[model samples]
Target: MTGPDSHRLVRSPGVGSVVIGPAADGSRRPDLVVAADDAIDWTVFDGLTVPAGYPWPRIIVYEGDDTGFFDWARRRPIGTFEWRPSSAHVVDATGANINRLWIGLRTAPLHLTVPSMPHGVLTVNGDLSLLTAVLADGGACPAVDFQPDTLPAADAVPLRLPDLPAFAGAQHVTVTVRPLRQAFDCASLLQFPDTRHLSLGGQLVNVAALAQLRHLRGLQLRFCPDLTGLPALDSWPELTHLIAFNVEEATGKRLRGELRRPGREWERSGVSQLRRPEWFATEYGLPFSGWPAAKAKKATTAYRTAQRAIATATGPDGVEAAIRAFVAVVNAMPGIETTEREDAGDAVAQLAEDTPFGDLTEDAQDWFDDARDF
Candidate 1:
């Protein structure tokens, strides 16, 4: 008898043939990724046999019309359904990839829906029409990320949020990146019904409107220049992780919630896990903008300079020195506080994220803590 640690094939990412390999994490048979690189018909898998008790494939459609792909994938439990382009993937559950899936980034304008699919991330980047179609198809993911690729010209109408899905399921919702100009009220948010984590960007106009979301466990505010002050943290019973940096002394670090970097441009929350603080600011709200002309210019110059250094590092090993330099800059700043310290640390994490240096996760948080004193 074989030991339980023996490897098994989990998924196959082949076309015209079935290519198998050992499961890196240890399964029963050889493992493979099921998503094909090219847009192929579902019939391609007809010849790929599975053991009687093994599960069917969970395919990822990277390009082309998914009408046919949906017809086939929806047949099974739809274990993990994703219509992401090579770019449109969202794996932002902080670090959990077991019951949930990590969806990718999609730059193209396409709408796809697989009804009654299991929990995953839904990210729409081109138009609200895409969002509309997916909801219409009865598709639902626990997390919904809505970002329109571009804004209409000043003379044109801005994109608007589509009506909420008829059923309730979303647990984490992010309406950010590229502002929505159609004038959104919080009522559009109330429709989610089950959202425990909510993130909003430049379009935020009022904070009081969130009073009704008593179930919220976390909230993230990004670039809300028009934001009214936040409500008292204690008012809500379930809210935990909120804003990271405090601009107003009224809240200080006394906020009842901890801070977390909201999901990023390509890496939703995190594909693996959010181990420690990756505290990069999404730029300032009102306080930094109101600084004296020279002071504001200096801050921008400092940040941009640090960014250039980080990106131009000789290699992965050099990123540490570059990040350490950034910490020096933050520590040397005038009136250094939690906000400034977080900004410096976050800038490194956010910028290094996609680079080879980012994989050096164990060293990052410690670098910030070791070099800087708040």
Candidate 2:
């Protein structure tokens, strides 16, 4: 069997500098090293097989020709593999071999594939049709974090139900297409009613169509700058966790009201999970001053008034009154960012539901505690 120290001479015209070495971590396994040379075709793996007792290399150091390198890597067994595409133009071949690769590696959950391009920005510059083909192949994976390099062109068609069977059983799906100049509708996701968690990010104008995903237990909307409105949540009976970031003020207030009201079954099941936008602003080093003392006092006063109202009122009328009071408190606090207001809204919603304060699971509770300080 070929060991890590074993040397093999692969001679191709104008390719005399290829060097395979031990794993960078100083492991015993060898590293498959390939450099960009037009004379070298990466498809050489088509006729080669892994030698017994010498597993496929876990690390690949390819300095050139990303397109050809990925084409070769796609055919190999998908184990614990890492790639260092040192070239400036690395193109992931997932679109071409996702079906075969995903099927063979279904047992081991793979990290979600993000676009790897010359620029660091998450943008798609190549053929958008490849995405449609890859998803339509119906290879099951647990979770997918898909971010297109760019918005689909005017002539591009929307992805439909039949094209997304691969995600039918997925537990989580996160799609971010931010700063979109044109409208891109993802209403076709309504076909996958089994999807329990849905996260949509970007500048897509409206996500009202997503309300059709009735099976969702958790929903996250992030940095959707143009999303100024939302439809009624009466359709999403199973929804328990709701999160939003960087949404319009009016929309945030309206959602707070809807989440606090008591008669709605969905409203009673869970609370809104909001993160203060100011936290992000501070973390990202945006210009912001601390909240004024007067504004803080006013917000505290509103919160106390709402607590009293909830204590005194009874039935649906009391619930409505308490919700109004909570919204007033949140609106009065200008210092709190949109996300913080959502978190506060969730706290009040839990109170209205007669649930214990800070009743979230350990992980969630920890997140909230951390968010409070951030």
Candidate 3:
């Protein structure tokens, strides 16, 4: 009996045929065998005459002694290659002569260490032998404590992360490449861009091409102060949480009324979760609230008096959109103090019923519904 172990049978690149099987009584038939598409298939068994051109002559015999299941995963790359697990499962596993193979990478120069089918994580670490730069003369992997080595060279240069086709089911992708001053391709690691988290932090890049990543859900941009305005995020309907710090505020009056409001509410209510010493600006510590009763009558009177002074300057529609979007984004963040959700939800309901925004109100209500689920 063959012991527990995996096996491989492969010939040269262009070879046509290879076969393995058992004799009459089926004693220890070379456990597993693998073959090629352009190859011939033939077999012979006891009491069975030489049948010419049998439909599938190759045979895989599993004797009665062992109760084990056989799995076969095959990839045939003829200019087009796919290492995806879903596609790997449907390969033809008809005969014993054609043994089990796995879905793995088969590219020039760079070799891959892919996982077995059904469920396996795909990993591509920075290895010199396994990864080589195509366009540049040569490459270097630097030693940074927190970040991945500088890719090719940082400034305005184009660099490629080797593609991993089997990573279709990946949920999270962490790239060590930091101070990324240039554009990099993440299309391979996150095929379903809307559903996955794409974290880019500690990078020197000014503007990233994240608009192409349509399905991106979570984004963490830290210390990327050079970036002026975030790309159009209204398209990312699936996006739940966005953490941005030190970003330039071209619209200060807008952000003043938006991002700084809910945090001020937590601070006013003596909630420690919203009070971070790192982000504290002495001028920005004033109390603010979304609900009607969080402030006293005198405070509310003073706020409305000041609000009237700026109401004409800050257009009503724009202010409403910013507040609603900000509230939706903050509520989506985990561990957030969810005190004003009912108030916010009621506000959305009123807007939906009475506002001139027909489709926009519906969209806002859907956003709040999803955000409150977190």
Best by lDDT: 1
lDDT of each: 0.47, 0.45, 0.35
What is the per-residue lDDT of model 2 for residues 206-238, given as tens digits with 9 covering 90 to 100? 377776676788777765545554665656787
Error of 1 at 234 (Å): 2.4
Assess candidate 2 and give its TM-score to the true structure: 0.40
Could you tell me which 10 consecutive residues in candidate 1 have the lowest summed lDDT?
A: 270-279
**Clashes by residue pair, model 3:** 33-99, 34-99, 59-96, 60-96, 148-176, 193-215, 193-216, 194-215, 194-216
Q: Higher-lDDT candidate among 1 and 3?
A: 1
The alpha-carbon RMSD values of the candidates against the true structure, listed in the order shown, are 15.5, 19.2, 24.0
Rank by TM-score, highest first: 1, 2, 3
Question: Total clashing residue pairs per candidate?
Answer: 26, 6, 9
Off by over 4 Å in 2: 1-33, 36-128, 132-141, 151-162, 169-171, 263-374
TM-scores of all predicted structures: 0.42, 0.40, 0.30
Q: Please write out the lDDT profile of model 3 over residues 42-120, one tens digit for every residue.
A: 1222122224523221333221211112212122211111121211122222221112222222221343222232222
Query: Tens digits of per-residue lDDT for model 1 on 1-374?
Result: 02233324335443222323222221222223333333345544444544653344543323322334444543433334344444332221222222322233344443333243345655555455433333434334547776644432222443345675632567788876422233234556776767888887644444576777778887776544334456665556676566533222223333322223343121122111111111112444212344456555665666566567767877866777766776666555565533344445555554455555556545767776787755
lDDT of 1 at 366: 78
Candidate 3 weakest ten by summed lDDT: 136-145
